[model samples]
Every structure is written in C-alpha cells, then in structure tokens.
Target: MNKIYTGILSAVCLDGSPPAYHYAKGFGEGASNWMVYLEGGGWCKSEDTCYSKVQNQGPGMGNSYKKGNQTAFDGILSPSQTMNPNVKIHRRGARVFKAIMEDLLAKGMRNANNAILAGNSAGGLATILHCDGFRALIPNAARLKCIADAALFIRGKDLPGAADKRELSFATIVAFHGIDNFLPKSCTSKMDPGLCIFPENLLGDIQTPIFLLNSAFDSLQVSSCFFQNLLLELNSYILCIHFRTTLLKTIPEDHSSSRGIFIDSCYYHDQIYFNPKWIGPTSPKLNNKTMSEAVGDWYFDRSSFQEIDMENDFPRDCTRDT
Candidate 1:
C-alpha cells in the first residue's frame, strides 16, 4: 500500500486536521487503470455528533500522520503496515477525497486510460457525491466510472414517523457539512440540498457511467434504515423491497448499455471489496458469477449485464463464518 500523508496534500478534513487514504498502485496492465476507493464509516448529523465522532476515533482519528509512525490500515485499506480497527470521521470524506485525487494526479493517474471511483456503505454515497468531480479531473480518459456499493439508500413511498426523522437527519447533515455549497447546483436549486444529496436527485446530473452494487436485504438498512427509534429488525424486509424498486426505476435508462447493477439476496452491507464475498469457489454465487467476475465483465464491457436475486431461489443468510 502506498501511503500519501495528508500533511502533503492541499485539503484538510472537517476538523482542520489531515487524514490519509490507503492507496495501492495498479500493476502491469492494471497500472494504466486506476481505482480510487473512499473509506466510509457513517455520518455526522450535528455539531455534538461530530464532536463525539472525534472522541471515538481517539488521537488523529485513530492514526496520526503527525506521529510519524506506520499506523495500521484495514478493510479495502488492508495488507498495509499493520492492522487496527478504528471508526471513520464522516464530515471529512469529500475533502479527503479531493486531496487524494490531487496527490494521484501528481503521481501518474493523469496518463490513465480508465478509472473506477468507488466505495462501499458511506464510501459508496461519497462515490456518488464526488463522481462528477472525478470525471472532470480526467476529461480525456477513454472511460471513467463510479460504483456505489450498498450506499444506494433506497428512496420509497411516504414512510411516515421514523422516515420523517430520517429526513431531519439529512437536513442536519446538509448544514453541518456545508453539503449545499458543493452539491450539484441544479439539484439543490430545485429542491433542498438535503434531499439533493440523495442519489435519487443527483443521478440525473452525473454524466459518468455508474454501477450499483447492493443487497436486496442490506444488513445496515435493516437495522437502522432510520434512527435508533425506528429499528425494524427483521420486518424491514418490506422497506427493502420498496427501496430496491425505487432504485431500479431511478437509474437512467437513456444510456442503459453503459449502466450496470448487481443486487443479491445476501444479508450484507459491503461485499465486493472484501475477499470472501468477491471471489472463490465457496463465495456467494449469482448466476455462477462471483462479485469480482461480474464487476470485471461489466466495467470492462465484456458482456450485457444486470443481476438481481430473489429470496426464494437463494434465501441464504450471510454469516460471518462463511
């Protein structure tokens, strides 16, 4: 893993602090293609929530570039200097992303022919938020795409009570993070920036090809589709069904061939980036294709594609032991 210290970058995180992203230089043929992944933990809805977030992350939001020590990185940031688990600081996502790209441009990403800007969970949402910016960076690239994993928070019919509270959270986030200032002006102009932050509103403005990767029964959504007050537990199944329908409908059909979607019945959040879920004989199979093969085929334009799993055919519950 190539570590680009935040101190050398142009942007600082929300707290006026520096945070680094774990970067891996592509190899061989892969060298010409770039993959920039955003790390996601969750979001900060209020000033207090933001403060609590820093506290939870300890000094330097887990590891400090100021310390001059190789703090461990995991998940997609894994196989690094060491392994240590830490919570993510959400408000800083967009800025961290901008800085990462600036450093990559200075390296050799400018000569790349293809680039995949992707992330899972919160990272997935960030991929959508920053997709346009990334495309602008490589205006001459032959192909540039965005992949959102389990971050497509399914929008649906009027789900009152808890749903209203969730909307409130969105409002808080927009103000807390100054999301309106950077969001697509057209989207925020027509509606609240809080609502504009959703892919449902921003998808139309994104000119880049996008791939949506999610689970029919996303674990994270089932638990907290709303706030702690709206814990649906297992009964959130209804919500998932409606949300998927809305997501499928929202994707642009104009350039249908350029778009791709993969949703399985597995009860998991982010899968493709993790080894067990990506590939291997024992991995979760969708039409005899592992996550890696499906993504490769779609991103590389190897075949026509769109996969959705039903509960009856593969009603398999995902267990960590698998």
Candidate 2:
C-alpha cells in the first residue's frame, strides 16, 4: 500500500477567523503529485451534528450568537437561510479560502504537479470557484479534479470565470446526490434571482470525464439528470452513473435519529456520501457515506486509472456553445 502523510492548514477567512483544510502529504508523493480537497461551504466545521453543537455551544463562540450574550439560541442561523441580508459577507469566506489555498501551493506545502482539486457540497462549489486562482498561482500543468456531492448553488451570475480558465485541465468531475433533495429548492425556481444556477450552467464548461451518481428517491437526482442530459446533448465528455435505491423513511418518535436527519440534510450541506453497509443496514434511513469513497469509486471505475491526462482544455461551450 502507498504510505500517506496528512497535514492540516487553517485558512483565516475575510471574517479573520481561520477555516481548515485537511492536506494529505502522500498523494502522488512518489511522482511529485498532489491533491487539494476543499470541504463544503456550509457552516465550516467537521462534526456530524454541527448545528446541534452550535446550539449546545450556545452561540457567541462561533457566530451562532453575538459575543457577550447569554441566551439559549436556535442553531439554524446560516448566511443562506437568514434574512439579515449581507451577501458579500458570505462570499468573503470563499475568497479567503482561495487565498489560503494559493498561499499553500506557492509555499510548496502543496505540490503543484499532478494536483487534484476536490470538494463536496459548498466545498465542491468552491473547487470550481477557485480553479482559476489555482492555475494563476501554479502555472505548471496540474490535474484539476472534483467530487461534488449534491452541490449546485450559485451566488451570482452563472457564467464561468477565472475558475474556468482554459489552461487548466480536469482529470474528472464526480458529482453525487439523492433524488428528493439536491440543491436548495430556491436555486431551481426561476422566481428567485439570488438562488444559485451555476451547477446547471457548469455542464458545458466541463470538458473532461464526468461521473454523476444519484439515488432514485432523491430530488437532487432530477437536477443531476438535467445537467447530464445537457452534457449528452452537446456530446461533451461526461460519464454519468445513477444509483437507484429507495430512501428509508425515518420514524418521527426517535429524537437521536431526528438529530441525525438534521445533520445529514442541513449542517453538512448534503455532502454525506457513504455506503449503506458501513453505516449498517438497521438505520437505512440515515445510512450515509463520505465523498471520499464516492470519488475513489469513480476514479477506479475508469479504464485509464493509472495514467493522468493533462492535455485536455476547458470546454469551449461556456464561450462559444452558450
């Protein structure tokens, strides 16, 4: 087995508080290869029940409440779901994350050659957002990749920008989701302007091999199919896989399980991509997997798993075809 070493880097967002990235040292170590895995953009924390933690922590500590206040607060406060209305504040976090990633790559802590850029949910969106920034910082040819799990929200215009730079080549993009839910419903509705549409618009910009996984019962599956059809229509190089399964219904009486539902659906931003076996068959309703497993499966399933393709250019559909 290939030996792997891991390091964690904390990036201070525009808010000045640091967010972290788990950087693995041994990825492509033998051949000077590297990969960057960006976490999703929901409240940036790594725990199963982040919202509950926020509620238990009782605000003030991490934006759940104003500092110096003492009150039992509802833990559902988020930039997206809130009406206070400061859109730029939310974007600031993404910019800070990009800055930190660039700094790490330039400092040689992250290898530029054979680098795989990846993320789930909001993290997946960030991967696409930061693609151009990564290229500008590291001019050397590197393999850019992603594993976006049910992440299709767009904050602003749906057009591809620096992240879609032509110089960068995608190794593959593996997107996963359930059917009943994918991105927030607001994003899909034409009535809402602030909602995201980038996920749908991104289909044409993706030029490399693409794999999409979806559950039959998931609403996100519908959105995934929409994008897949778009790619198929254009004859783009995208490979889609659908995992058809019935979602287990949860019992309302179970409190512990109710918390789990909130964790899976809300806090993590729907990045949970796990196998049903590991989570156990008993809790089929809550059995979930991580993005890592899904991405690994996609790569291994490919015919040319051993070699990396660096010559492919960004799809011109974003410019000419659109």
Candidate 3:
C-alpha cells in the first residue's frame, strides 16, 4: 500500500486517515501505460450510516492503517501482457481521488504514454463523475479514457409517475457529502445537483472518451428499486420489466465513435474486477469478445465496440465464481 504522507493529502479520508492505493509498476511496452482503478463500496447517505461503515468495514475501507503490505494484481490490474494487456474509498472519495492522482503525478505518471481511469459500483459512478477532471490531470498523456463498471444508477420509474425513491436517496447523499460544489457546472447549471450524481445527467457533458460496462439487468439496481418502491411480490415482475425499459431508454442516443459500450443481459453488477467475469471462461461476451478484449480493443483503437445484448429483454443468470 502506497500511503500519501505529504502535507494535507495525507489526511484526506473521511476518518482523517491517509488515503492509499496499491501500485504495480509495468514493464516492457507497458511501462509507459498507466491504469488508475477506483474501488467501490456503496456510499453512506447519512451520518449514521457513515459511522456504521467506518466501524464495520474497519480501516481498510476509509483508513490506510489496516491495508495489507502488498496485494496481488488480478483482474484488470493483472501483470500478464496476454491477459491484462494494460492496467477506493472514503465518504470523502472526491478528495481521495485528487490525492492519489497528485501522488502519481509526483511519482513519474507525468510521462505516461497512455492512461485509463476505471471503477466499479460506487467507484464506477466516481469514474463517470470524475471522468473529465481525471483526463485534465494528465494532459500530457497521448491517450486517456475511462471505464465504468455497473455504475449506471438511474433515477428509475418503478411505477408510472411515482416519486423516485432512488433519486431521493442520491439527493440525501449529495447533500450529506457536500458534493454539490464538486459536480460539473455544465450539469448543475442546467439541473438540480442531485440529478448530476446520476450518469444519465453527466454523460452528455463528459468530453473524454469512455467505455461503459454494465449489466442491462443490473441486480443491485433492480433490487433497490423493488424494495424502495414497496412493490408487492405479485407486481415484482412488472417492476422488473418497467425498470429495464427505463434503463435502456435512459442511455443517450447520440454517441460519438470514440465512445464504447457493453451492456449485457446478465443479472450481475461490477464485473470488471473479477477474473471470471472480466476475461475467464465464464466471462460474458458480445460479438464473441470478452469484456477485457472489448475494453482493450477500444483503448488501443483496434475497433469500436458499442454492442448491447438484445438477446434477452429481461434479466438472465450469468453468475460466475470469482
């Protein structure tokens, strides 16, 4: 674990602990390439929940003290050129990102040839929220892009014209975290800051190239909508269908060629960090290419991948052991 011990950057986490990240330097042709992955652990929308997460998850989640001395590089961080080809925290996550990037810039990332910023779940949402800013940080890199895994959290319409409970939750989080000040001005200027937390609101303004990896039937999102809306078991199937349709419609129609998307039919969430789901035998594929392949191709400009699995309109079980 590389802890940031320099100045104010040291105490950036919610608990005022030093924020840290694990680094695995590259070799050969991969030396100039950099991959910055932001980890996800669902957010705490209230102070009570924040305290609970700090206690329950220990220093590993928001504090660097308990982090391991070393961690194996797996999944997208794999060192194998054949496998990886390339390439957390806090209620104060926005600050954590800044500290990590500053540390990297100081430690030789300024000469990076190519760079990627990626994350899953809440981290995925962070990737979306911080996409353009991350690129601006490494303006010298020849190529820079972002990847969001299971990060698309929409303010879904569980019932016709019903108030969206999910939006309210996001609003609470935004207000609690004091994140309105950090949201993109382009989005906040046009809509409520709470809405900006949703990728649907921020996607249009992001100037950097990005690859989106999401399950069309994202299990966590679907379940959250079901329970929060208080839908009866008899109407659960109808809620599923409606939420799926809403998710599909919410994705913007206008996408430039540089953008990439891989929305599969699996009822899963956060696939990028798991070897089995990212590139192994059970990895979900579209156009006969796994998620890792598609992302690599897009990053290297080998091909454009914008395919969505239209094979099934509803969710299907494509679960794989990690």
Candidate 4:
C-alpha cells in the first residue's frame, strides 16, 4: 500500500481543500486487475456545511488520525483491513475522486485486464456520476464496471425534505461539486441541474456496467422516528416499501434480465463498505448468499443473482421495524 499525494493539482477537493487518495497495489493473481474505490462520506448541501465538514475531518487524518494504520481499506476496497464506521468524513469527495482516477491513469492502470470502480454512500453516487469517464479512460480493459453501495438516495419530488427544500439542497450540491456538468445530457437537456443530478432520474442513462449494492431498507432515507410514526398509523408501511421498490426500478431492463443485485432486507445503509454488516453467519442474507458472494459472482460473472430479500424472506415492513 502506498499513499500518493496527487501531483495533478488542477482537481481540488469539494470544499477547495487539498485532494488525495491512498493506493494499494494489486499483486500476483490480482495484478492485472484494477479496482479503484472511491471513499464515501455524505454530501454537504451548502458551502457552510461543506466548510464545517472539512474542519472536522482534516484533523482525523492529521496528528491523531494514525500514521501507523497504513491498511485503511475495507470490504471490497481492500482485502486486508476493515474500516471503522466512525472514521472522519472528507467533504472534498469529487476532487479527490478525479485526482485518484487521473493519477491511476498516469501510472498504467489502463493496461489492466479489467477494472472495477466502486464506492460507498456518497462515494457510491460519485461512482455513478463518473462511470462513463472511468470507462473512457481505459477503453481497452476487458471489462470496466461500477459498484455503488448504499448510494441510491431518493431525490426530487419523492425526497423526504419535500420539493422546495429538496431543490435547494440538490442545487447546492450540484454547484458545490460541479455535478451538473457531468450529468447525462439526456437528463440535463430536459431537466434543470437540480433534478438531473438525482440518480432515479439519471441512472437510466449510464452505459457502463453498474451493480448496485444497497439495502432494501436503507435507514438513512428516513429517520427512525418518522418511520415509527408511519407504522403506528399504517400497519403495513406500504408507502415506505413502495418508495424503496421505486429506487430499485432504476436498473435497466437489460441488467434486470441478466441479474446482478445484492439488495437485502436489512435496516442499514452501507453493508458492503464495512465488514460487520456484510460478513459472518448472522449477517443479513439474501437467498442464503452474503453480500460479498453476490458482488463477487456479479463482478466476475460466476452466477446470475437477482435477490430482493424484501420480496422473499422478509415480510413487508419487517425491515422498517428492524
């Protein structure tokens, strides 16, 4: 594992801070494969929030953040170590992502046998937004795919914040991260920047092979108190399940036909990014397959898997209560 401070400085952090990423060189059987994982931290809706995020995260990587813990990779990012969920959040996501991919290209990543661009949470969304650019950079690779973990957040009219607030929040992120410029032209040409950045509206346009690794019951979408209130009145919480179902509907018809999903009936956000939620006998299971098994099978094409635990093992709203 090596830490590379990007020499290409044009790409700065999301908050105008310095951009950087840690690299773990693949070896032996994996040497010919390139896996670029974008670190995930939730996005900031405004300059004020972005600034605050930087201040909190900057120190975690500094004096107290641990110069000794070199193996920071977790889940699919690296096979060596597990990431602590409490790790500091870096708000300069878009800049750091661009810098890393650019740096990798300069270092011969394009010659790899195949490539996997994966991310968690907000980084998952970044993976979606940058899927095409990644493939184009290494068009010669045998296969180039993208994986997004717990990144499918509901946006637009369906967002919990309502239309007006959602518009302001999305607009701020687009301006803050310069996301509008990368949005699929098909979406942006018809919708405003705010609406175009939402995945539900834009995922249909992504051409690169993508595998969504998220939970059917992503707790972050709605607060627990709110969900509990809904259950108190609506015995089934059908509305919540319906919303979750719609998010999965973003997958293309072709992908759906082939089968590459690990969505489960877990009340968590990002299981693939952390070990505890993804591994072990007691972990959430879909058709008896763990998160890693499903992802591996899909990325390597070992098996055809399309699992929606909500529809099979778990009863409707069972996850909402869990």
Error of 1 at 232 (Å): 6.6
- Cα-lDDT of candidate 4: 0.66
Best by lDDT: 3
Per-residue lDDT for 180-206 in model 4, tens only? 766788988998988776777767777
> What TM-score fits each model?
0.79, 0.41, 0.85, 0.77
Q: Report the C-alpha lDDT of model 3 over 1-322, residue by residue, as the tens digit.
A: 7887644544466555666789998899989999999888888877667655655554335353344345488778765433443202346666667778888887778889999999999889989988888888889999999999999888765544324577778888899888999999998999899888988888887889999999887888776644544344555566667777878777786557678999898887889999989998889889999999999999889998898888887677777543
Which rank order by lDDT, best down to worst? 3, 1, 4, 2
Q: lDDT of all the models against the reference?
A: 0.68, 0.35, 0.78, 0.66
| Native-to-model Cα distance after best TM-score fit, residue 200 in candidate 1, in Å | 1.5
lDDT at 306 for candidate 3?
Answer: 93
lDDT digits (tens) for residues 1-322 of candidate 2: 1111122133233222334444445534435666566554344232223333343432112233345544454355533323232321211343345555665665573555555555565566655445545555555644444444444442112222213421111101211111113333443354222122244434334433333321222233222323434444764433212111111121112222101111122111243333331132321222233333334544444322111111222221111111
lDDT, candidate 1, 192-266, per-residue tens: 777876777777777778888887656676556632424354444455555445546655554475677777877
The model with the greater lDDT, 1 or 2, is 1
Per-candidate RMSD, Å: 7.4, 17.6, 9.9, 8.9
